[model samples]
Target: MLVDIHNHILPGLDDGPESLEEALLLAETAVANGITHVIATPHHRNRKYDNPALAVKLAAKSLNEELLKQSIPLHILCGQETYFYNEMLQDLDGNLMTLGESGKYLLLELPTNYFPAFIFDILLELQFSGYIPIIVHPERCEFLKRDRQLCYELVRRGALFQINASTLVGENGLTMQRFAKHLIKHNLVHFIASDAHHYKNRPFLIKSAYKYIQKKFSSQYVTYFMENAKHVLEGSVLQPIPPISFKKNSTKH
Candidate 1:
């Protein structure tokens, strides 16, 4: 059973599926893609969106009922894709934004082409607050493009990095694709999430992504992703896969 740690499947809320029908379709697609568990990571703490915690809970309950009614076995968990802001700590304290479904891992989304000077310090702040921060899609961050060393430094400071599955396939572009591949090959990537948005633009799927990782890398790494995700769900201790050293690029393209 594969667990999708990041996705926007919650219905009629945030930027994901505009309607409940689309939400159901995304959920169906998730099931068809061999995802037994999915976390509905609605954008929070950035879009100034309302706290859909109640709505998400209701959606999960209804979806479970309907799935059971149709005899389709799939579980949709609840989470939030929190954006980086100064008020992040306040939101966490207020319980307006949650981490992974189990509340053990916080998915922190950074700016597109800009990173604050205090980014590392903020991560340490989150850790000090007793919440594990999973830096979402660091490959897509402009800060990383300018200074790849920062990513390595982040990992050293007890921060986990998540690479987008589609980026690994070059869906975004060549640059991101190469960076995504580099992270995986170097063992810097700890999670591979869909970060899926709508159905057409960024569909909710994981099988191809899983296969890509398995074929390009070792099956053990795939299992490693699965094991770490499972540990997050079970609220167990999430350990890093030994320290990884970034490969020094020798060729000057």
Candidate 2:
């Protein structure tokens, strides 16, 4: 079964669908695109949005009931795309919902354009606390885009990376598309999720993204990504893929 480890399909949560009707439309789009299960990762403590763990779980439960009532055939799992904050560890001590509520993988979103000076320390702390930090969309972070070797360093430090399907499919532009491919080729990316918000604009393009990967890379890589996402939902430990160093010539655009 195809599982999407990230998305904002929950209604009235964050910047996703505005109402239950819109959310149902998004779920239908997911099913048509071949996604059997998707984690409804609403924004958490991102300054503007504050979705607590229990709230997200309740939201997912309600959405699931509605899906069943309408026979959508798409399952919504509970999770959060928590923005990095200094007090995050304290907040997550018994709070923040991990992907699938499995208490293993946490979907972490860093600042859009830059990584905080103490970002590495935060990731290390999370690791010591028995939680694996999955960095969402590093390809779009301007800091990582400019200093691509940071991708290798982050993976080496035990942080897994998830690239958005939009980036892989070039919807976000060619620069992000190339960076996404670069991470995949160097074995730094662990998952491909649709950080999808709406059915019309930010749709789930996972099927097309996998097809692109199969054509440009190998079926092996595609399988690896899919399996990693499954592992997140199952709360299973993933054997890390040792990252390949980027040749000096390939480090920058």
Candidate No. with top lDDT: 2
Local distance difference test values of all predictions, in order: 0.74, 0.90
> What TM-score, over all chains together, does every model reach?
0.89, 0.96
Estimate the overall C-alpha local distance difference test score of candidate 2: 0.90
Residues 104-192 of candidate 2 have per-residue lDDT tens digits of: 99999988776699989999998899999999999879888777777788899999999999998899899889888888878899999
**Candidate with best TM-score:** 2
| Model 1 regions more than 4 Å off | 48-52, 247-253
lDDT tens readout by residue for model 1, 27-143:
777777888887777777576666446666776677677667776667877777777777677666454545445556878888887767787778888788777888898887876
Counting clashing residue pairs in each candidate, in order, gives 0, 0
CA RMSD for every model? 2.4, 1.4
Which residues of candidate 2, in runs, are more than 4 Å off?
A: 247-251
How much is the lDDT of residue 102 in candidate 2? 90
